[model samples]
Target: MVWIPGGTFEMGSDEFEDSKPVHSVTVNGFWMDEHEVTNAQFAEFVKATGYITDAEKPLKPEDYPDVDPEKLKPGSAVFTPPTHPVSLDNPMLWWEYAYGANWKHPLGATSTIEGKDNEPVVQVSYNDAQAYASWAGKRLPTEAEWEIAARQGKPATIYYWGDSLKPKGQWPANIFQGDFPWQNTAEDGFTGVAPVKSFPPNAYGLYDMEGNVWEWCADFYRPDSYTKNAEINPKGPSSSFDPEEPGAVKRVQRGGSFLCSDQYCIRYKAGSRGKGEVSSGGNNLGFRCVKDK
Candidate 1:
């Protein structure tokens, strides 16, 4: 874990609607994981506690009463890129719900984590992340803490490293480098999720703070969260609300994923925000932990 010496920093960006109206925020110092939780770390937790992630558990019939009984199988959303150029408007073209896709089988039931223990574990829901944090005697970081840590005492810029996407003509983080969904040139040396610390660490020595995988945070997501005034150690809104999906409860997710691209989702920009349904897990989402200091 790295000691994040927290202080006041700009908390939002003008690049996105939800992150609009940039604001100031303050936070206290905390010990944060230097990198996202890896397959080895999570495997230890599961082996010790016999924990079952939400992706591995069968969906309760009562939870999806309207859905077909046969469809309520254990699985998660996997990023299945299209073979040809497709409209970016519909993400369903590239995202498919793969039955039996869980943290153990990142891509699907047939996929395995063998020899890839250093890679960040994906397909972990917000609830599953919380469970791992509890077992490790740590907690998910607040959105504020996460932002400041990612900033690394540097001024706000498009990329955590700086305004340039690639500093000195080298990929500083793992992000999509080619056409969205259809092709990934792997210019960053990674076509899929990169192993933790594969890229250079931020100024604060935190790895994968901007990419690799979307990280779960400890806050209820609200589109207008920045509008509310909680300058110091803001824990986010009291409740979750996404005008687009009001019925689904969501938690704040930070950092972006390997799928992020300039042609599509650019939430990897500094101060930008991401949110995910609490009960949902995906191949591009995972989390790290933080300890109070």
Candidate 2:
């Protein structure tokens, strides 16, 4: 873990609608994990508690009565890029509900962690992450804490490193290097999840803080969260709300993922934000933990 000194800085971005109304935020010094939780770490937590992630639990028809029961089978969303370019408007083109896809089987039943123990554990729901944090005697970082750590006492720019995606023609993080969902040049030496510390650490000595995988934060999703604008360590909205998906309870996700590309999802930027259903986990979503000073 690394220590993040308390300070105030601008939060949110004007580039995205949800990250608008950039405002001032203050946070206190705290200890944070230097990288996303790895598969090996999560495996230990599960072994100790006999824990089962939400993705492994069967979905009840009553919870999703409108959907087909067959499609509601236990699964998590996986990114299977197409051979050719497809409609960017439809997320279904790349996201597939892969049955048996959990942290253990990231790609599906046919996949396994195998020798990738150092890779960040994906397909972990917010609850699963919370449970792991609890077992470790830590807690999920608030969105404010996450941003502060990611920024590393630097001025807000397009990314944690700087405004340029690839500064000095060098890839600072692991992000999709080609046309998203259809092409990947692997310019950063990875088409999928890379091992922890695969990229350079931020100014605060935090690794994989910009890309590689999206990280869960302890905050409910709300477009107008900035409006609340608590000056000292704002803890996010009291409840979740997303106008796009009103029925689903969502939590904030930060740092983006390897799937993020400038041509499509540019969420890897420092000031950008993302959200996911509390019960839903994806092959690109994971989390880290924090502790009090």
Candidate 3:
């Protein structure tokens, strides 16, 4: 864990509507994991407690009664891009709900993490992440703490490294490089989630703080929460709501993921906001932990 000597910094961004108003936030020091929690770490937690992640357990009919019972089998969302270009208007173009996909089988039943223990574990829901954090005697960072750590004293910069996405043609993090959701040039030396610490660390020595996977934060997401946030140590909104999808309650997600692209999802930016259904998990969603100091 790295000790982040947090202070006041401008949170959110003027570029995006949800991240608007550019509020100033103050955070206290905290000990943050240097990298996103890895497969090996999560495996130990599961082995110790004999725990099963949401993706590994059978999806209950009562939870999703509207969907086909056959489609409600144990599974998670996987990014299976189309062979040809598809419209970006629909997210289902590349997201396939693989019945056997879970943290153990990242891609599906046939996939394994035999030699990839250090890679960040994906297909974990907000509850799963919270469970792991609780077992580890740590907690997921609040949205403010996450932003403060990702900023690493460089609060106003667009990217963690700097304002430029790639300075001198050097990609500082793992992200989609090509036309987005269609072609990936692999310019960042990664086609999907790269191994933790595969890229340069932030100023505070936190690795994968901007990419690799969208990290779960300890906050119920509300699109307009920032407008009502406390000036100091704001946790998040009292409840979760997304105007675009008001039916689903969402938790905050940060950093972005390997699937994020400049042309499509520019959420890789330090100030960009991401959220997901509390019960939903995805191949590009994972989490890290933090301890209050």
Candidate 4:
């Protein structure tokens, strides 16, 4: 946990009605990881707690109705860059359904974690990150805390760095710089997920707060909550419909993932967000732990 000297930050965005009434909020001092927890860190947690991630557990046939028992084998999300252009309307243009992908094997059956010692561990669910955080004696940060640390601008700017996406001809963070998903120019020195601290830290010294992988937040997601309430220290919605599950879920994911792009989900900014069932895991989602002071 790294100490963050927090202060008042203007929250939300007026450009979008949901992020309107950009209000100011203050946060006390707290601790946050320098980067998203890496595979090595997750491995340490597993070693200390004998924890098994949900992706490693087999999926029962009933759980995925109509799924082949063999097809239910452990897997994770894998991004297979296309050799040519694909439909812009479809996100699946780059993300493939690998049969045996996981944190250890991000590229499905053919891949292994043989060399990725510092990359942020992907394929982790909200519950998976929570368990690890609990073991580490920390908790996920609230959305307010996350955004405060992701101070790209002087609080009110739409982006963390400034009003300009590419400030002074410099790439602010590690995001896809070429054609989204497919034709990555690797202008950011990476084609897929890069090392944990591959990019420079934010104003608050938080690494990868804008891109890399979406960090799971401890709040429930409420896409419309900001529009309906005060923007000060908003904790997301109390609850919401989770199409990924059978009932309401209570988790918020921020910071955006490598899969995020202007061509697809332009959620790599400080204000971007997404969530999932607590028990579900994907190849692009991971988290970092935070502790209150």
Question: Against the hidden reference, what TM-scores do the models get?
Answer: 0.98, 0.98, 0.97, 0.89
The count of residue-pair clashes in candidate 2 stands at 0
lDDT of 1 at 188: 93
Clashing pairs in 3: none
- Reference-based lDDT, each prediction: 0.93, 0.93, 0.90, 0.75
1 versus 3: better TM-score goes to? 1
How many clashes does each candidate structure show, in the order listed?
Answer: 0, 0, 0, 5
lDDT tens digits by residue: candidate 3, 21-72: 8988999999999999999999999999999888888888997889888877
Q: Model 2 over residues 222-285: C-alpha lDDT tens digits?
A: 9999988688999999999999999999999999889888888899887899999998899999
Which ten residues in a row are the worst by lDDT in model 1?
Answer: 154-163
**Over 4 Å off in model 2, which ranges?**
68-71
Better of 1 and 4 by TM-score: 1
Q: Per-residue error at 261 for model 3, in Å?
A: 1.1
CA error at residue 243 for candidate 2, angstroms: 0.5
